[model samples]
Target chain A: MHVTPGQPLMVCEHCDAVYRRRILARREVAHCTRCGAILERHQWLSLDKQFALIVAAGIVFIIANVEPIVQVSLGSSNATTTLWGAAIAMWNDQSQVVAVLAALTLFFFPLTQILTFGWLLAFARRGERAPGFRQAMVMVHYVRPWSMIEVFMLGTLVAVVKASSYFKVVPGAGIWSFGVLTLLITVFASHDPRQLWHKTVGSNE
Target chain B: MTGVVTARERGLVGCHVCGLVSRAKHVPPGAMCPRCHAPLHRRKTNSLTRTWALLIAAALLYLPANLLPIMRTVSLGNVDDNTILSGVIELWRNDSWDLAIIVFVASIVVPMMKFLVLGTLLVSVQRKSRWALKQRARFYRLVELVGYWSMLDVFVVALLSALVHFQVLSRVEPKPGVIYFGLVVVLTMLASMSFDPRLIWDRKETDD
Candidate 1:
């Protein structure tokens, strides 16, 4: 069986003229103003780049969860907690809502999104079209809001400050790592969407 | 009633791109034309109302978030209560200035910035103004991106509260600020969601 690569095609709304991706990118306007036809719209990223980013993000994510996020000390006592520790603590405190929210938003959702994106991109790079491309894309959209590590981080900071009067507080290495991870996820996720869409749907256009 | 059918009715003049009404008749389907390629719809779905609802909720929550206590810590048979700012100050006193600053910025600064920036954007779009389209979009993205950092304060509190729960020696309890902080997070997220990106483009188009 012969497999053909997906090529970029732009269909004009007004003139119905189809232009190649390169041609559309060079033009100032993506659509014909006079006839109201789409002058340019095409896929932009290749499979290799998508897979590389997914792998890099996954490694950072693991580091974020495993390391100590912050350390606290009261007189002679000191302790540290990782991302998982925070989740477990919340559950034990009977704040099940907060615990579940923290778990899903900070850990579970991001993990699932990263794994799914990586699996799909890796498979697609090898010329094997993954089943349920659209479903995976929808899952990405759903998981996007639940990736709340950054928010959780901020809340932790506030809580630490408020608690400092009685105890000494220190930001652990995990805090810094988590910050880096947050930035990485934001930038990578934004870029990844465009790349993924291009790989999956732009090729067909 | 007695007139003959025109060429326009024969799909000759209809828009070739979006399939809207056109004046010309028998315009070849493959032929590139202006009207046929125009956008089918450019407006957002109830943009103003949605933005207002989000902004109002944010404004309402912003109050309790600052007023309520975020964490309560007990140590050496003494109970010391503090809010978000006090926490930062406490960290500063402990020589953890860097961590203090981070907490302050993430918990206090970022949340306030989200409210101000989002409120401004919402108002600007409602007025259909064309000022600072690119800058506004950047601000919006920044707010959305940083909104989650506020959770740090909550996590730290929960963690400390758990670790220090050593019955007579020390115990830390979550203050009312946890609820407020959670509200702040939700409100900010809602604010970001309510402000439509398309509004930025719409105003830009109007200006152009």
Candidate 2:
């Protein structure tokens, strides 16, 4: 029953024993089965690398938002719209679900998550463990579910094809950039969490 | 009293705090009870069942999404329906290389890869086979991470449907693919959710 840092603590609940730190990082399993017992708890992240990724992802995100994603043509009339423009177009047409979804998943959620993660990472890098680190981490977790920009992009492609019969839809530079941006963000986000956790914990200790 | 070794004496410990019971031998030096944050014993619960259920549901949904028509169109003079592939091809023909590639990768390649890779990992875990547990976990994580990208097609559809509302001149409507694509996303997400990466370590411990 004795607890101490640097010692692997196992929890037994319902006759099951599991390591404490693993459960904390994964945040799902929290009980042992055999004889229920409390387990170890640890949470940390790396500040420096996380900051770098945030900066890179932030710049790409800004570019993705500013550039036009697709160009549409009907007869001789041609027009293009950026990420935000697409959302506005949806809202203007009364497609509230689509508009809100587009805005939140593609633009809002990601923007917030990246910015928040970046801020936390920067602060942590300065050897300042803000009391709100846990709160910020929760925000990152919540935003993770909503950051579905890439998925929205796929749905957009399907929509374009269905609409092609009525109008000529052309892919724009923004679309391509956004596509790459989606891939980059996906990779960076996945890597950032694990790396940040390592860095933050290391620095704090 | 007669000489008797109780379960607890046999290394079976129960955490009164969280009601978790496990073999005392496996308990970590400082490990606490998972449920109540009390002390722990040796054995831990396996999370494979929950993860497997999730993965199976994902696999089930993945099938219909691919086979069904993603988009349905009703035009004034013509009726041209499109699937995910047809949509990508249209982009390619239109000289929208970037868009076409994006569509191909996000809607087609990435989702398909996720399904295959995740399915493989789940199957391997179920069989309790340890080929590349760490690598498999990493792959599962990648699939979970990238599962959202499949929404690219969906976003395009929503955007176009909203923007191209000129009425008689032209209009686009949601098709079955929107639903199917949504299902794909949901299924993959479920698959990711159901996967228990800890299963990988289970095999390692057993081997050790």
Candidate 3:
């Protein structure tokens, strides 16, 4: 495959058919000719747009970590827990592996995503490439599937349903924050990874 | 000679990163994709070995996950410890049939089905049995999609443990079973990733 400076060679991963990459007009998408899988979309958000989303996600993530997700009051006494608190409570109860996984999926990976993307996008916005940007992009791809905030939130909903049968489960600031954060993360992740890699790395390959 | 042509017949290998078909003959060994820098692999390295390892690990974890208590609730000097199956039965007894079904399918049915399906696919591939190739591929896709939902039970335990505390009067906490169960879910997902779906197509050229 002779990849000229502008015309890059593309292969369909689904069907293994090679084709010359073509430019697309705004709102146009390139699909694999053999398998009909989406190859690339033209109208991707700019780096600054992605940066704005990252900032919003970062704020919500902080709130979700700090505030209580739910508070339960039975008689005179009450109990509340933030996301980390839940993981720690599991740790104290001898379920150490689950606690560690909870922390990694819910807290660690998402924060790493935000920080890595924030740095890369900031560099791209300034028309400059940061050192290790390629590595960061790879990290983002690997981390995306492992970060299970949406799944965790759904689990929280199921927990709430289970708890609602026995006692009053008051929704707290953390739950709302987590909801918003999950949405933002989805929005952030939905963009085509190929396009982002192209913009950040810039036709260098 | 006018029969079905494979990608290898045309010297084409798909780029896993950019989804582009490139001529395999022209690319030297260990060359990166011209469009994207991802390293090219004809098939995932050590695909079968890795898949088997992960599958066995998941199977081992499955034992403790189902046998032990997932969560325990202590209320007003009374105690109840619920394993995955017992928890489903408790939900059914309480007349929350919908929740019971959901938990049953997500927790019980999904894992078992995944194990059976993946094991079958592995066997068929190893034996070079070209039966229902397309359906088998679709089944693999289903296994991938349904992988995360199995975590529902674990999340429920975490949520309840965090919320339900009555300072000496009542308490709820996750048990050791959940940790093992969580491991089972993750290990299976990793096993799926280690599998190469393209291997399913490779059989077509060799058989039938």
Candidate 4:
């Protein structure tokens, strides 16, 4: 039952509810009585286990990028496209702005998030502060909202369903990897990235 | 509830990025968070004006996003321009009621709700209305929660457009409306981000 206390006080970002910080027991979560926003939590897993999840997500992300997301077969001449291939295909097809938007939300932002968290965890593993820790933490916040990997996954499913009627569309390996990556990322979200700032708790990993 | 103290009341500012509380009696405006380097502020600066600006832009684009054709399909040389609502109807007519509803809600219902809920929040905060502060706080969270889903349509358009490029059988291309719809999603998200929910409680705290 090892645990580390965070700052002496905490404030709810969503509702401005403040509380005297509590040392949470393992798997326990404290919610703001005022607005019911989560104030703090004792994460279910330590940093090491969480870092492994992020690494798995990273590998899955690469597979999602490289493999074909959708394969179209019409009379033996089939076309298969990966996520990157889709974005590049769109780029060359005259809708460049939409292409960039698709690429950024689906690919670039998630990659940055995985790499940033991975970097932070590597330093935390050794009980040493990561370089540019402040910038990295801030980047996590800004990037969280924009990284719509799960949204992409859902939208991709929707597209696949809608397109199958008109074409011989088969869901490819990339789509399944995207589903797995979405689940891994959701697990990552449950940990609350800000918890990484607690040096004592982080060192417990 | 009677004697509760906020972080601000004790001269402590919480780092918005990391949630770390710090004494902030003499720090300059826009002081960076000591732990995370995010700018610490009592409240988001000009939250209302910025929110209103983005909301107005989104509102302006919403019409075109829904009216103009978002996708063009050429089947055997017959061209068809499909707007968002029409796309939903096409899906419905094609017997995909679930996908139709999903697209309808994500692309249409979600943004309209953001504009209305956010507009209400902004006006309520500006009017210093003490009505339903807790519910309003929840609404702010709801706004943030649903904002990203609005991008569903844009991604749908991008993916479908990326596919369906067959030379002779059929071709689907993204039209002007998707870009506008995409911009609307982005703007509303920004507006939601800029409008600080803390303002909903400012008036009540000061009355004490």
Candidate 5:
């Protein structure tokens, strides 16, 4: 780890261990010498690549929202529900808390995060700072934990399997869209998001 | 090891928001990071108190979350009510052991482990044991990673309730227990976030 002149210092978020920031080659990672939390990583995706993934996820998000998540058939009658319809049905069931929770986790937070990323990247791509960059970054951190898309996907699969024992169930286009959205979002997250703090204007480094 | 220095000893606080290392002592009241304009604090305020409160609330709710029925299935005049545990058994009895294990771990095992691990970390930090510091830090990370998976069961209940919506043939309805279970998961998640792992490294001595 060769530190450059006027090198910036970084303190581990997991531990308080401080170290001078160093230049790393592509695909290299810097681990905290203390508690072993990752300090930095050379992400595989460039800004354009990540931006593309974000856009693709945004499109898939729409499809996931609009299409039916699953279709159930019982004798002569059949039913299909989208994520929005499900949340509304949940609300109609009189459990406002669960309804809101379902709405926020499965729909609202992910949408907000995507919009925030779009706003942040619009400016960051040009070597500038996004308006409300601080709030945006904080939202990203907080919302990432609560979004729960992949978890929702797993839940759908489990629900399908459990429902299969009782009746005819079919996973729908929305489930496929959700699957794709999960991969795109995962890909974006795997590329360390903190790198944005370094790339934008007013960078400490 | 003897040569190691911390931001605290150097009177510097790295910006928790933007990673800018700046002097701590000289900053004016309500100082914000110059780069991102985030308010700077050496440590998160009321970390332990808040974590304990939330964890305890979650523990209290864990009872109803388990004891009462999470969801009920009504089909052809027959009703089957299942709690978190019984739901897993229902899945298993139906011969889906893989899903049974997944639900068992995520819904049941994960939250319990969080309570135990987080409770231990809080006690250890208060006592300042200075033992296995590295492992404690890793434990906190693990808690954060697995904390959200507890929501899996909640979603399963919601989707199941939403999909099987028919009067005569079959229908799924979330019971009051599902609400308590949802609260338990959310509370534990907040508890884990309220915890600040850096506290594990703080010492009372003049120097390490």
Candidate 6:
């Protein structure tokens, strides 16, 4: 509970009750006394494991973008599109705003989040803080809610079922990769950035 | 025993991002929190008006979202255009009861409820009605959380348009209505974000 110059003191976001901040043991979580909200979550996974997961996620993300996500055949004509193509198609068809929104939520923001996490984690692993470590962490938090890939997947499932009545729809390699990427992103995003920041600052106290 | 004092009673406000507490008077517009370097606001400025504007825009878009075709499917030279309601009905007719319910709730029920709940919250807050204060706060939380679920319909349309393409046999394309529908979802989500839940408690002490 010692208050140091650089150490952050916390208040409950929901209730505004001030409290001293402390690093918790693995699997430990600090809860707000007034509102019962999670203030911090410290999990047991070391930095390396999280970094490996991020690398795996980045690879999967690449595959998702490169491969065709779905293939459909109706009588004599068939069409296939990658994730990027889906948004671009909309853009070409005059729905410019929706297209841009789709691109940002589906691709750009998520990519930014992944890249930021990769940079921060890489620096943290070497016990060196990145120049923009704080800003990157903040960006991750802001960008997280906008990444709607999993929701898009759910929509895809519904769309596939609806389309099945008219013609044949086959899932593609991109679909598989997209699914895997979604899970990986969720796992990595769920880990608290505060704990990661603490790890990067090191045990030099 | 001392009386229970609320945070607002102490003139304190907490930063949502970093949980930093400071005197509300000290946090002017564009001021950053000392601890987290995040922008500090006593209350989100113009929260009510901004939320109202966004919600009204969503309401106007809701009509087109439901009335016009969301997707057009062409199969063997036969064209079928389905609006949100028609699409739900088509799912029902096809015996996909589960999916039909899900689409109906996500696309139709949720947005309508969001508008109603948000409207009621605005009215209550404006009038400073003390009735159901806790419930109103909880309701706002629910709206904030589930606001994005309405995007389910937009995603479905986008994915279908991308996937269901066959040169002459069949093709699925997004209709103009889907654009409006997507706009509606985004607007409502923004409205939810613009609302300051802390205001629910603020007026209580002031009005009394």
Candidate 3: residue B119 Cα off by (Å): 2.1
User: Using lDDT as the measure, what is the rank order of every candidate, best first?
Assistant: 5, 4, 3, 6, 1, 2
Please give the lDDT score at residue A154 for candidate 5.
93
lDDT per residue, candidate 4, A45-119, as tens digits? 788888899899999999999888988776666777777766776677666877888889988899999999999
CAPRI tier for the interface of model 1: incorrect
Please state how well chain A of candidate 1 matches the true chain A, as a TM-score: 0.69
Give lDDT tens digits, candidate 5, residues A1-205. 1222375898888777789888889879899888889888878887877877888889999999999999988887888888877677668776667888989998999999888888888787887878777778877866888888999999989999998997799889999999999998888888766678878765443
DockQ of each: 0.21, 0.16, 0.40, 0.45, 0.51, 0.39
Candidate 6 runs further than 4 Å off: A1-9, A19-38, A42-44, A75-77, A196-199, A202-205, B1-13, B22-25, B203-208
Least lDDT summed over 10 consecutive residues: which range in candidate 5 chain B? B199-208
True contacts kept of 2: 0.20
True lDDT of residue A175, candidate 4 = 92
The number of residue pairs in model 4 that clash at the backbone is 0
What does candidate 6's lDDT look like per residue over B54-107, in tens digits? 999999989988888988988789998989999899999999999999989988
* Chain A TM-score for each of the predictions: 0.69, 0.69, 0.89, 0.88, 0.90, 0.88
lDDT of 3 by residue, A103-175 (tens): 9988999899889888877888776666776667667767877888888787777777678778878989988
- What's the CA error at residue B191 for candidate 4, in Å? 0.5
Q: Give the RMSD in angstroms, all C-alphas superposed, for model 5.
A: 3.0
lDDT, candidate 5, equals 0.84
Leading candidate by TM-score: 5
Every model's TM-score: 0.67, 0.60, 0.86, 0.93, 0.94, 0.87
Q: Which residue runs does candidate 1 get wrong by more than 4 Å?
A: A1-80, A92-94, A150-190, A200-205, B1-43, B132-134, B201-208
The lDDT of each candidate is 0.62, 0.60, 0.78, 0.82, 0.84, 0.76
Query: Using alpha carbons, what is the TM-score of model 3?
Result: 0.86
Segments in model 4 whose C-alpha atoms lie over 4 Å from true places: A1-7, A200-205, B204-208
lDDT of 4 at B203: 56
lDDT of 1 by residue, B1-208 (tens): 1232322223233222223333343333344334223323222345557767876786787677677776666666888787878877878888878887888897889888987897887778768776866577667768876777777777777767665666777887776667667666876786676555546544233321
Itemize residue pairs with steric clashes in candidate 6.
Answer: A74-B169, A77-B166, A77-B167, A77-B168, A78-B166, A78-B167, A79-B165
Native-to-model Cα distance after best TM-score fit, residue A142 in candidate 5, in Å: 2.9
